[model samples]
Structure formats: C-alpha cells, structure tokens
Target: MNFRARGVFTLILGSFFVSGIAGLVYQVVWTRYLALFLGHTSYAVIAVLAAFMGGLALGNAWLGAKADRVTRPLLFYAGLELGISAFAAIFPAYYDLVHQAFLAVVRGLQPTGILRLSLQFIFAGLTILVPTVLMGATLPALTRFVTRSLAELRGKVAALYAINSSGAVLGVVLAEWWWIPSLGLHLTLFIGAALSFAVGLVALILSRRVEALGDGVAPATVTSEPAEQFTPRQLRLAVVAIGVSGFVAMLYEVAWTRLLALALGSSTHAYSLMLATFISGIAVGGWLVYRWKRQAHTLAAFAVAELVLAFTLFVSLWFYDLLPWWFVKLAALLARSDPAYFLYEWLQAAVCFGVMFVPAVCLGTTLPLVSRV
Candidate 1:
C-alpha cells in the first residue's frame, strides 16, 4: 500500500474499532438490563440474542445492497454512528418505559410461558432493533468506503473485520471487569455514546476532505462481486448452508455457556471469562483471514473448518462426562488452600477454553471467508 492508501486504511480501521467497542458496550449492558426485566432464564438470553441478531441480519443485507451506490459512504456511516449514539444515550430510560408498559398490558392476563416469552421478545426487539441495525451496517459502509481498488477489496474488508473483532474483545473484557463494576450500566451506556459520537464526527470530517480531494476527478468505482461464479441453484444452496452454519453456531454457543456455568460456579466472573475467550477466538480467526487471505480457499477452508468443528463438538461430550471427576479431584487437592475458590475458577475457565476454543476459532474463520465470497 502507498502512503495515501495506507492512511485511508488506518482511519477506516480505527473508526470501526471505536464503533465496535461502543457497540459491545451497548450489547453487554442492554442484555443485562433485559435479563433483569424479563427474568434471568435461558429463554430470556435467547430472546435478546434473537432480537439482536435478527436486526443485524436485516440491516446487513439491507445496507449492503445499497452501500456501493452512495458516492460518500463515510457520510452515511457517520449518520448511522450518530444515530446509534443518540439511541444509546436514551436506551436505558426507553427500556424501563417499555418494560413497564409490557407489564401493565399483561397484568390482567396470566399469559402462558411461551406466550409470555414471545411478548418479552417483541418488547426487547422493538427496544434494540434500530440501533442494532445501524450497528450491522457499519461493516458494509466501511467496506464500501475503504475499498478504492478491486485488488485491495478483500484484504481491506478482512482487515477491517479483524480490527473490529479485536476491539470487541477489549470491549467485552472492559465491560465485564471494569465498566459495569465501576460506572454502572447507565454511565457505561453514555460513555459508549460518547465514543460513537466521536467516531461519527471524525468520519464526517474525513468524508469532506476526501470529497474535496476528488473534486475534479471521476468517481471511484465500486465492484459488485457475486459470492462466487456458481450456478443460481448452487448459489441458493450456499445461502442455505450459510443460514444453517449461523444457526448451529449460535446453538453451540448457548450450550457451551450453560455447560460452563455448570462446571464453574454460576458467577458473573465465570460467565465473563467464558464470553471473553469466545470473542478472543473470533479475533484470532479474523486476523488469520487477513494475514493469509492470498492462500485461503474460502469454500475448501470453510468445509474443513466445519468438519473439524463438528468433531470437536462430539469430542467435547466425552470431556464433559469427565468434568465431575476432575473437579472432585481438584477440590480435594486444594482443600486446605486459602484461595481454593480462586484456583477452582481458573481451572474451570481453562476447561471451558479447552472445550470451546478450537470450535469458536473455526466459527470465526467463516465470517471473513464468507465476506470474500
């Protein structure tokens, strides 16, 4: 990359990183707030994730379809960031209002479990849909804005995703270990808002500068690359496979989370550690994609990764059966130790890592590879 290309890449990467941190901050706090309102059940977690991911899927495809058409995508990205910041600033209050409204409406009717869960999901979905959709658009907007040449497009997208994933790792750790503990959810939300607003302003300024630089020049071309040169039927099949991959990945994540809670004590720190490890694996996978993009075969690598992931999932059951015996042995070994609880927590985290890390890493590789396709 030349100096100017490198400069633009750096700015895009940094902007996305800031946005990623703010986005995760909102996710962490909002999910906790929703859990409180809806009751801390497995269904509640699923509801929140479904709402969030549903918004993302819609927004990603919606914005991605239009991203390349805009002459100044950075300005569009700036608008999205600013809007998300505004939403974050008011979300806690909005959530409370929505929760109260839901309760009042359901007071006369003792809804069944399934009905109640559906109601809760609707309320949560309304609360998060707008901001989360905007969050989902960031990748496409940045990808569109940063790719000045066809040769650099794949690498640019991969690198941007890797940077954002790395930032999410930081966000998860900080929100768990520091932000929620130190600032509380309300304050943390505002802090995230500030970060997001800052990114918006920076993007806006950069957009104007770039526009001026290209004042007399022809517009930069945007390529509309299809997933791959497959028959329409094959393309349809690939889409179905991608959907299945997403579903199975989320299913495994939910299962692994519950398993971790069982093996480790159901402590906040334990949950945080598990989440952090999962995100770290994603960051590693994105980095690998960017670092080895030239050598990577999207379909072949994804297929092998999926097979390995399935094997790991099966093998994990055998390890799960052994956990009780090992925990018993560890507890007995540390019976007289003052920091026995701490030691056990660490061991539990290690076990969780061992069981989930390889699969999570494989799951991570799928994103950038799919992006290239």
Candidate 2:
C-alpha cells in the first residue's frame, strides 16, 4: 500500500497524485472565478472558501457512504472524476448563468447591508458547490480502495495523503505561476478538465485489472460530520480532539491567508502561493507521520505533534508582522517592471513559505497521527 516502488501500486499512487493536481487546479480556477463574481472583499473571500469547503464536506458525508459500500471503489472514484470533468467542461456556461441569477436576485430583492452579504454568500456557495461536491467525494473512494482494516490504515493513509498533498503543491504552482499566466483562465480550465478526465480514464482501466487489497476500511478522515459513537470514552475523546484540531487548522489557514495577502498582494497568484506553501507543509508533515506511524505510545506522539503545531502557530504570528518589513525592503530594491515583478513574486512566495511551512506541517501531521492513536 505504500506504493513507494514501481508496480501497480506505484501506478495507483501516481494516478492519485495526478488526481490531486487536477483537484487543486480546479480549486485555483474556481476560487479565482468566484472571487471575480463576488468581489474580492474579506467576507466575499470567506464566502467562496466556505462554499468550497462546505460542498466537499457534504460530498464526503453523502457520497462517501457510497464509497464505503462499493466493491470497486476505483470505479466510483473514476466516476466522480469524470463527473467533475463534465462539470468543468460546462462550467463556463454555468458561470455565466450564475452571474445572471445574481443580478436578477439583486434587482428583485433590492437587499442591503447584512442581507446583501448573505445574498453574496448564498450565490457564491451555490456557484462553487456543484463540482466541489464531486471533488470532495474522490478521497473516500481512493481510501476505500487503498486499505481494508484499522491495522493497515495508519501508514498507507498517511503516505497516500502525502502523495495527494504533494500533487496539490504542484497544482497550485502550475495553475498560478505557469498555466493561468500563459494560457489564460478558460483555456486553463480546459486543461484542468482534461487532467481530471485522464485520471478517471486511467483509474477505470486500472479498476478492471487490479483488485483492492485491504479487507476492512477505516476511511481517511477529512473535515466533515461527527463520528459515530465510540464505546470507549478514550476513543470518543480522541476523536473529538482531532475534530477540534481540524477546526483550528482551518481557522489558522483563513487567518494566515488573510494576513499574508496584506504583504504578498491580493492578486490571484499571491493567493495560490499562500495555498501552495500551506499544502506543501501539510504534505511534508504527512510524509513524516507516515514514517513515524509505528512509534509506540501513539497518543503521546499525537499530543506532542499538537503542542508543536500550537508552538508553530505562535511562531508564525511573530513572523507575520515581519513580512511587511521584508516587503518594504524589497519594494525599495525592485522596480515596477516585468523582471522586477517576477523577482518580487517569488521573493514574496518564499517569505510566505518561511512563515507558514513549519506550522502547516505540524497541523498536517496531527490528522493521520491521530488515526494511529
């Protein structure tokens, strides 16, 4: 299940890695599109993110059930990817209709203040949830295909997560730095859709030949609904604790991105760098967790990881205020030209990574580490 070596498992790993890349590409594309539609205010940004996250949560809860029961989870995953591709293919038309609906609702209701914001959130959520639900459902299917029982769940899930996150890092970089800059949005979307379709098609082909190895599934955890009742109080507490950690992790992401944007520029590219740096740390942390999965006293390891995560959060805060100082120094050095812009862009991304990387890693480690406990 490690899929570290060359073989069918390696192919599966690569497939999921590509899937992760496609998923993040869609996220970058969708977030940029929705931001343009809703306006780039703080509340608007949160609305877009909330909608995206909400849809994924819904998918994991609902479609995830199907993922659990399906004998060929690979096929289910293929179907989900194809569904996302289909949505992406039609998203341009749908994007236009959503704007029309937004305008119509505004004209009819003539709402103001909180009502206006609520309307924005509602429209933003509806606009994003369509494909994101399908996007959200992918991991559950992959997870079901990967492992069978609680015993095999720990390392395999952690490694798979790391692989997916690694792909996400590449996706963010490519979407923001390379694809959108060179190809433009609509074309970039076509590329994203194509990647999703390719992954699904490959998965479909693989599903026919390889059978799942695991017997029972302890599915990979994401931020979704509450877990079923645990007979043991300790188990219940651990589950709740991890849930809280995930909540706090999201708060950190939202807060950090909002703050970093002030220093990094609120351009679409800057947002992508912030996301990439964050996920990069997560990917590294997941890899670390996979490596250390067999440590004795798993609970202690989880607690220690949490403490490190908290400490890094404070560390990031200190670094956050220093970002402006670094930016100001660089501003004096650079000119308002293409080469300067290029230099400045990567410089700011580096600063973002420096501040965010460690904390995000700790945060990422906690999720899979908890499963070991």
Q: What is the C-alpha lDDT of each candidate?
A: 0.76, 0.80
Instruction: List, residue by residue over 1-373, the lDDT tens digit for candidate 1.
Output: 5566567667878888988788777777777877777777444556667777888888888976677788888888898899999999998789888988888868967687889877877887788888988888888888877766554565666788788878887887788779899989899989999999999999889888875476211223343643244457755765776788889888887787677666665555566677667877777877888887353356787788789888988887877867767777776777556588678767776787787788888888777766655
Residue 220 of candidate 2: its Cα lDDT? 39
TM-scores of the candidates are 0.89, 0.90
User: Candidate 2 on 1-373: residue-level lDDT in tens?
Assistant: 2233225556768988997898888888888887787687455557767877788888988998899998899889999999988999898899899889999999999999989878878887887797889888887788777766655555577877899999989998889889998998899889889998998998888776664543323333432433322347767778898889878877887897788887876777777788899999999999998887344566677788889887877766666677788788887898889999878877987788777898889888887877655
In candidate 2 the C-alpha lDDT for residue 351 amounts to 82
Model 1 poorest ten-residue lDDT run:
214-223
Task: Report clash pairs, candidate 1.
Answer: 227-373
The candidate that achieves the highest TM-score relative to the unseen native structure: 2
Candidate 2 lDDT at 168 equals 89
Residue pairs clashing, model 2: 148-214, 148-215, 148-216
